[model samples]
Target: EDKVVQSPLSLVVHEGDTVTLNCSYEVTNFRSLLWYKQEKKAPTFLFMLTSSGIEKKSGRLSSILDKKELSSILNITATQTGDSAIYLCAVAAQGGSEKLVFGKGTKLTVNP
Candidate 1:
């Protein structure tokens, strides 16, 4: 199945460390970019950047999309242990036809 993969697989950070989670994908007829934060429960939508919304930010988390490059990046600043979780990246086709193809996710661990 076409999919995405994140590097490092996991990360460790202190109470106030900046981190960058990477996501690389390979899907059919790429559509848009999606980012979610997974913490025990299902992932919660963090950002959805289509051709219309290519960049998004909320507090300490921010992300950008590059359709031409066929990749995206997510950045987090002053991360805390509460920020600890698996960050997931997904790709969905236009018109929302197929399921959201997901990456293996990057597990982030924050230490106090």
Candidate 2:
């Protein structure tokens, strides 16, 4: 089985604040790392990171992958109430079909 852990399982922050979410994984045959934000419906894809690239950025959100530490972190700047959601970290294996193993996730609540 895959081992994935997320720190600070929950967080509460005010608007304009910054939050850092962490995820560490020890999955055999790891192929890539992925981040997702779940608000209500389905989870929305945020970023996908592979061994070749260690960092990804999209507007006020950025993520980094550390191969040496086998972990990844997501940073959200200028948080807003709309940003409140469950942030999930998943890892895909390198087999024929990608099987994603996900962590419990960190629930972020951005207050006004």
Candidate 1 per-residue lDDT over residues 1-112, each given as its tens digit: 5778777699998989999888877777777879999999989999987774356889999998877667788999998989999999998865447788888899999999
lDDT of 2: 0.92
Q: Which pairs of residues clash in candidate 2, taking residues 3 or more apart in a chain or in different chains?
A: none
**Model 1 segments more than 4 A misplaced:** 94-97
TM-score (all chains, Cα) for each model: 0.89, 0.94
Superposed Cα deviation of residue 100, candidate 1 (Å): 0.3
Candidate 1 similarity to native, TM-score: 0.89
lDDT of 2 by residue, 47-71 (tens): 9999644579999999998888899
